[model samples]
Target chain A: MQFGPHLLLAILEGLVTASILSLTAMGLSLVFGVMRVVNVAHGEAYMLGAVLAWWVTGLIAGHPAAGFVIAAIAAPLIMGALAVASDRLVLKRLNYDPDRTIVATIGLLYIAQQTTLMSFGPDARPVEPPFNQRIALPWLERTEEGWAWFYPWGLSITSYKLFVIAAAALILVAIWLIITRTRAGLLMRATQQDSETAQAFGIPVGTVYSVVFGIGAALAALGAVLVVPIQQAHYLMGGEPLLLSFIVVIIGGLGSLPGTVIAALLIGLSDGIISVFFSPTLAKIIATLLVAMVLVFRPRGLLGKAPA
Target chain B: MLEATGLRAAYGPVEVLHDVSLTARAGEITCLLGRNGAGKSSTLKAILGLLPPSRGTVTLDGAALHALPAHEIPKRGIGYVPQGRRLFRELTVAETIEVGLMTRGEGRETRDWVLDLFPRLRERLGQQAGTLSGGEQQMLATARALCLRPKVLLLDEPTEGLQPSMIDLIRDVTVRMRDEGYAILLVEQRMDAILDLADRAVFLETGRSVETVARADLTPQTLHRRLGV
Candidate 1:
């Protein structure tokens, strides 16, 4: 492929990765931002989503879209319920002490991964996309004719890939609206700012924590459902998502929604382009170093303010 | 009316409040007066369930409160303007009020009423609470609590760091609230404010409710003797 076409393909691939990553990272960010709890099991929730999506799709008949739709709706709901149960049974008992919650969630991560391994088996499995018609992308060039558009070889994207990006964008916009424009979101932000004061004013903060935890897990599950067709599901697939999300959330700034998206895009595109041009290992090493540099110079993140 | 009896609370092993008790009746500003570390703030905290009393009963019009959690206490008709204003700093002035209203399932009518009381807040509705002047922040804090439309209102040093004009505004609000039949529990150190607003004063000394003085008996000498100024 020519340079322009190759680069375009890499960018397209990066957008798909960025979409999935932003959803996963956002889940972690919301839980951290609101409850001040670092949920180490967040990636396990994503894994569970993928596993459940595979199961649901297998159970369904008829069109591939039918199963995909059912899995999309059911997986997140199940993850949300499980997350809320864990929060109430474990984190709440631990008093959501930052140090203790980390340890507790780490235990949750292991349990979730092992449970999936045992039930779902250790094999990596893929879900078929609802629709994947590939369309050749055209590149503009100055030819003998003033300006000409020609199809670049291998410069194409599946319809499903475009759908994934659109879905993620829509979901993110919905989340933004909820946070900025809704009563539930207002209460969540209030709880995040000052739990003590929120409680003093009759906001049931414990309920809010449970809801936030559930929502966070649901978001991760949604990401997994979306990406399962692109990437195979395995119990161990969570580790990469977890590590990458931590890096993204750190680079984006703690608890910043916009920062998370931008950082995800930056990291995702770079990972794609670099892996294509050099190596995936090199891409990851560069990302890790970027995180270290961010920590050293701008610990609060690109958009984070001084700790309130 | 709101009543707390035999309220005892501790910060870890260190006891901050022991055997404190007080009553705030409707149409009255019941002031809690004491020197520093006298458990005045702790008393209010215990009542609000912020610091759950190790042993006590808080009742509002005969309903038990100490049995509930901090969040539930406010829903049982108590509003608190805590020390330091405790405003949601990042939230805009309008959003801060919205939180208060959301807590009680209140509507725009109450918001309009609160805005009328502190018209200054209406102008800065779009500004973040942290960006407000000290007086404006205090107003926002008080206005937030009032949005609850609670039967019992708790104000902890509402005018502590205010200018005289702001202090007068707070005093007037307290008086007006009291006249509207809200039970007001005020924690204060200023003699002038206590004299002007308190219908009765509860004196605390070393985590204990030592005395209760009616407004008629709240002379400067009594305040000086009880407060040790």
Candidate 2:
């Protein structure tokens, strides 16, 4: 049981990290892929989700499940609305210009962060998970002198973490379904390919940009709501999610969802194992260094398409 | 009818089309013939509002087209087959055409007609358009535009890089669309395809429409002789 328990725990932790990372990164990738807009405020959107979840849950105290459920449903919707308003009111006015959007989103990031600070107060708070049952994990140990079969080692995982993994996966699948099986997806892909032609053929590129921005923010918020139970929601919490999503997106290929998912798993697993074995700072340094190599050698990221 | 009057367009400060006026009526195939850099494409872009003409107006069936955003022009019943057959290389032929349908908020029937026009595309509907040969890509581009089922179809060099057989197919489709009452505006470098299909030919020389010839009065050789090129 020497290394087995440790490995299992690390892997479980990695999977959980990957679940939220991919969810957040996919939104970033999709928004860039379609609208060619890099949402600098993506992390702020995540914080907003956690803040909204806290607010929704606060509305009905003493009922953890109801609060979680209401927050789950309402948080993303509110995040989506906020994103749409930002796109129409800010990004659209800037003509969705790439350089301008970056500045605009940076402004948005601060606006969101400060708004929460002014209204929600500058404090870290935790939301109660709807369920928190512990499930024991099994691991094999070395007998007195030889190897033994698998045995229980008191290793366990919380039920809410399992829900995070399942929910993230379901959302990813739903996204894949929409992107691959629906007409709206076709329009998005078309717009991504040639905005002028997409427009000439009947797509309103501006409207598509607004919708994509909204979806991107909503997905990020969904990931935040799911994790708010385990992680404390704070005004300062947006920084790490934002930084990690950028790493994932850059390493996965700026506009590639599949690459984002794979890179997320790679980063998350390594981050978890490295943090456990070494310092979290060392884990981060290694990840950043790895990204540097990918940039130098494979500029397109792990699975990004080469420019056509 | 699609009528563009005194269209003056520019790329930044350099003017491309100067006071160019033309018309493509429903039920006719009108060809815009010119040499390289002759402003034929610019004229089409101006009418489609992609260039946003610096002067004059483009009206489709009497409503303003130049004032509409490029995306809204198609909704007003104008379809375009841009030069280079700009298909989304990652998308399947069906998905590419489906975009045309989705933009108009219409569905399958137009797809059926497009597939009928280019049965070659029907077999390749599931294939990525970039995987196709040059000829097949041209067909997809034309098919995508036609699937929009526009009152006016703007084709910019449909026969460029295509084989002779593919040329015949595009020529045939152009004539068919004309007979079916789709106003077609085509830009062509190939005199043969122009002669084979154009009901009226407008010769553009250095941003101006120099002469307009009816089908009966036009001969590819004589037109070439007249231009003295």
Leading candidate by DockQ: 1
lDDT per residue (tens digit) for residues A37-144 in model 1: 999999999999999999999999999999999999999999999999999999999999999999999999999999998898999999999999998999988888
- Against the true structure, what is model 2's DockQ? 0.80
Q: Write the per-residue lDDT of candidate 2 for residues A254-306, one digit (tens) a residue.
A: 89889999999999889888887677888789889989999999999998898
Which regions of candidate 1 are displaced past 4 Å?
A: none
| Stretches of model 2 off by over 4 angstroms after superposition | A141-154, B12-15, B216-228
Best by lDDT: 1
Locate the minimum summed-lDDT window of 10 residues in model 1 chain A: A299-308
Candidate 2 lDDT, B1-229, residue by residue in tens: 9998888999989999987888898899898877788899889888888888988999988898887888889888888999999888999998888887876777888889888888888999899998999999999998888877799999999899988999988888888888989999998887766776778888888898888888887884757665655
The estimated TM-scores of all candidates read: 0.98, 0.94
Model 2 lDDT, residue A263, Cα: 93
- Fraction of true interface contacts that also occur in model 2: 0.86
Prediction 2 global C-alpha lDDT = 0.88
Candidate 1's fnat? 0.91
Candidate of highest TM-score:
1
